[model samples]
Each structure stands twice: as C-alpha cells, then as structure tokens.
Target: MVCATLALALVGCGASVPSPTPTSNRTTSPAVTSSPETTAPADAAAVFPVGEPREIATGLSAPWSIVFVGDSALVSERDSARILELPAGGGVREVGVVEAVQARGEGGLLGLAVDQDRRLYAYSTGGQGNRIQRFALTGTGGSFTLGAAETILDGLPSAGNHNGGRIAFGPDGMLYAGVGDAGSPQNAQDPGSLGGKILRMTPDGGIPSDNPDPASLVYSSGHRNVQGLGWAQDGTMYASEFGQDTWDELNVIVAGGNYGWPDAEGTAGAAGLIDPVLQWRPDEASPSGIAVVAGSVVIANLRGERLTVVPISDPSTAAASYAGEYGRIRDAVLAPDGTLWFVTNNTDGRGDAREGDDRILSVGLAG
Candidate 1:
C-alpha cells in the first residue's frame, strides 16, 4: 500500500448570496419549481416502489466514486487513494493506489469512469493540480490490478474545497467532467478559466469539435461547484450544484448555457443565465452524486441526509426517501440487476459516524 496524505476535511465553502444580474430577455418565470415538501418522501411510491436500502459494503473511508467492470465494482477511497474492487456476492479487495494522490480536504482521488473497452479512468489531485488518468484493467474479479496510468487531462484548478469532481461519459460517447469554481466566485463566469465549468473532451483528452467554444474545452460555464452529473434516456443532461449558503440547484445543462453562479445562486431568470430546474436549501439538499433510474433521477445528499428522487419529465414534483435515515449520502449509481447502489460520506470527518459507518447500500426498485 502506497502511503498518501490523508487531510480529511470536507472541502466545501459557504458565502453570502449575491444579487441577481440586473438584466433581462428570458422570462422571469422559473423553468421548474420544486414543491415545498420535497424533503418528505411523498411521491416515492408513485415513481417506483423502492425497497429498504440494504448494506452491500462497509468500513469504507471517504469513498468518492464507483464504476463497474464486468460484475465487479471499482471504488475510489478519497483519503487513502486506494482503488478497491468489490466483486459480485463477495468481499472487497484493494487493487491499486495512486501514490501521487494528495487527499487534502475535497481534493484527493475522485470520479471514476470505465470505457466500453474496460479501460479505467480516474480523477485525482496531485502536485500540479487535479488531473484525469487512464489505466488498463488486468486480471479478473478479486484479482484485478491497474496497469501503468497515463495522464490524459491536467491543469485543472484544485483547492481544499470546491474541487468539482464528477466525470461521466455521455450518450454521445464523449467524456464530460464537472469542475468547481475553486473557491473563487470570479472563476465561475470567466471563459478562460477552467474552474467553474463543465468540460467535454474525447477519450484521448482532445477537444471535441461539437463544443460550443471551438478553441476551449469548456462545454458550459458559471457553475459554482457541480458535483453530480446524470443523463436521462434521451441524452438530456442534468447536474447538481452546491450553492453558497442559501441554495443548492439542479440544472438542465445546455451546450453553451451559463448557469448564473456568483451572480445568482438559484433561480435568476435574467437573460444569458439559465435558471435551475429545481432548487433546495443547502441544509435540506447539499446534493452530490446523481444517477438516472428508470425515468427519474436519484440524488445523494451530504448535508440533507437523504436521497432525493426527481422525475425527469416533471422535476418540479420531487420527493425524498430515507431522510436522516442515512448519514450524509455521497454517490448513487444504478447496478446491472436493476438495483441502486450508493455510498455514505459520514466518515469524511464531518458528520456523526455510526458503529459501521461510511457504508455502501444496495436498493431494489419495485413496480
């Protein structure tokens, strides 16, 4: 095991909300309005009858991201920089560790994406900054090892907090990354700054020609600290962002849309700024990793201490499940057997740790 730094402070910041941009063009009406009782598990039965969350794995420390290879799931531990493989119906084993990983605050190792060819991709913080590295999976379940890692993307801003770290391959076969503002509100609106932006690139880290900006890798800008990225069946993308104090948001990502961040936290119907489809209080929904299940989107909440379910067709009518039942939900992903697998983030030095805290739960959706 390669020893790595373990500075385990949760890296999200809080600031005063800014005034909305004094501009106009778009309608003042919000694109989506979440019902006030979103935190209550009201409409959970309407979408799908979800069973009680079952424990799949335990004793994980700050697990950040998860991706499946064959029947096993590859998970990243943020502080330890260790990649563990959890095979189906078995235990978890440490496969490899990124020695150069600096796991301070919200930095460290985060986000994992596996390609169709079984190649592994990881986002981690290093000496220079946050970067994406690709590796080949060797051997089989319970005996997997990562081949020599090749750095594909680099030069992203890194901080103790606000290090936006979520990566997913879109339906278009392109790689997409969600980055934070790096604690700098100004970076959210700056086109030249990679901070506070959603970047789209090819598997080789090359700029895609279809990007709104030809010369830049930025797909959308003005995001405060986007942590969750999910896609509906039709390729429509949705992202969850951490707001400065008052609000958190769920946004429908457009090619070049500017999600008003520092200038507007939640719903600002000003021109040139896209409003969030749903908004919540930071305490009620400090949302993180999100996944699309059936026709609804499932979100993991860190501070809200619950799992929020939002239907893509009508996001305004949202509901919650297991509110305060689990401690600080982090990542949620769909399993191959029509189950939902997610991780808890209580062991990251913030929440109240339970007896066997920081676990992974598997839930089945019925009807």
Candidate 2:
C-alpha cells in the first residue's frame, strides 16, 4: 500500500536485492531456512508429495495475490489494478477494481484475504498511501458493492521500494497487518513507531480493545520488509520477512513480541526480542505470502522463486522439518480440493519470465 522507498542515504542506492512489489505480479522476482530447524524431511519432495502447477488463466497483467472464497470463490491479479474472479467450472471476470489507485512501479493492489463472513479485503498502495479496503462478494463468484473504504489506520511510511503491506486475520479473529520499515531502519527498533511492525485490529476497521498497548497500534516490531503472514493452528502467528542478504526469516509471532529486525538479522535473540523460528539466505528465499496448512508452513518465495513447506507438530517446540522447490511462488493458500493454490510473480520485473509466466498454480498436498 504505502509504496514507501528507502532514502538514498539510508540504503536505497547501491542495492543488492530487488525491491518489494505491491501487486500480484511484477517482472521482479523472489522463501526460508534452518530452524532453532523446521523442515519437512530429508527427501521432502518424496515425503510430502507434489503435483503439477498448470496455467489456470492467461493474459493476466502481473497477478500479485490470490485468495479462495468458500469452496468456489477464486480471485487474483497484480499491478493491472484489478481483482479478477475465477469461477469453479471455468471463465473469469472482474470481481471488483480500485478506481482511484494509480498504478506505478511496485505499487497497486498487493495483498488480499476473505474473512469467515465472505467479505473480501484488498491491500493496495493507492494515490495517497497504502490502505486496506473491504468489498462485498456474491456466492456465484461475483463480488460487488464497492463500499467506501474506511481508513481504519493511516500514515504508514510510503517507500517506493519497501512499503510492506501484507494483511491477514489470525485464528483469534483479529485482523493483522504487516508493514515494512517505510525505508527507515531506525524505526524498526522503535517501539513507538508503526513502520516495520505487525498491527492488530478489529474486522470492521477498528483496533481491538485488548491489544498489548491500549494506545499503540503496532503488535510487534523489528521487521525489515515483512510481506507474508499466516497463523498456526495453535494460534501462533508466523511472519515471513525480507532480510538484508544473509538472513531472511520466518518468525513465530506472539502478541507484543519484538522480533529484533535491523537490530539483528537471523536467529540471534536479544534480551527483549524474540528470534526467528527459521532463517534463510536472502538470495535463497525472499519469502512473500505464507500459508500454514495441515501441519506445515508453506512459504511463497519471491526471489528464490521457490515454495518451501516446513513441517511441525506443535508450538513450544524449536525445530521443524523442511522440503520444497516450487519456483517463483508469491501468494499461497490451501485450496478446497486438498491442494495448495499459489500465484507467481515471475514477470513482476525481477525474475526469469516464461510464457504465461505469471499464473495461478496449484499443487496437491495431503490434506
């Protein structure tokens, strides 16, 4: 949403990795690592199982995100500034589109989620700043009633590059928002600041009354460009984030937890900060959207161009089993047919582009 770019003096100039994209597809490209180790098996490909990822739709302009509504509702798209619905039988049509959104480099519609009530949410970097808006959907795979977007919260740092804007709802039923540093590394450690933090709020554009700090909107801090978030069955929030070059991470989030981002990279734990449940080389896994299913955490990689499934049995444990190589995966979710539905950003201006490279793909995994 915000499109906040880091300052040239801070760290935007001589860049090593590519920037963060806001929509479903971009020519750009980009998951994670050893535990404290959560992974599948030594022969992960053999242990969990796999399926072919076919191009379910084509001619999509940078499809950035994907979310399945109920058993038949499917929606996806990227910087083209539109959310398209894919019917169960076949065919596609526009469900809803943001009219005032000005599409630019790495900015537009990015993240999306369908609540238990069938309401849809779009996280978009618009003309002003990144904001979350709600939309109504029909059971026939059609969504309408583009209601007024109530600005539940605002004033996120708008970085042209690292404006992290992934939003999710935890099992607790509270809406969670992931925001980047707005390019300011200093803010990552500042508990008072909202940038580079995971924010918790109510479904109706309101913050919960029982948040860690009554006046604070930030749930956790010390994140660089947190793009992906999912909740474990035990209600543990696992957030996937981008690190400098050495340590990208998958953190187990607790309310009011301080993850220690720019302060520390990988698994090093500070006195008051929590360490990552898993860490990876930035080049190996620039993880974006993440989905936890059955007993695994499925991380969608942006730069590494792979999807990694880490297996775990319970919380309180430190290690997890890992395995996977689904390339260029971005947004991912468990489909109704016991499959993992994921989207690709192979054409988002970063990674290698194939014919119909930007597509929604699904792979079978044990339910």
lDDT per residue as tens, model 2, 1-367: 0111211112111123322332221122233323332333323231132545555666566777777775554454556767787767666677667667655666667777778887788777776677778876654544333444555665666567677878887887888888888778888878777788888888886767888887777788888888898865545567889998787877767677777778778766356766666666787678888888756787788767766655543221212111233346677877777777777776777766777666777666653
lDDT of 1 at 313: 48
Model 1, 116-212: lDDT tens digits are 8889999999888889999999998778999998999997999999999899999988889998988888998988899999999999999998899
Candidate 1 weakest ten by summed lDDT? 1-10
Clashes of each: 1, 48
Candidates' lDDT values, in order?
Answer: 0.79, 0.66
Cα lDDT for residue 141, model 1? 74
Name the best candidate (by lDDT): 1
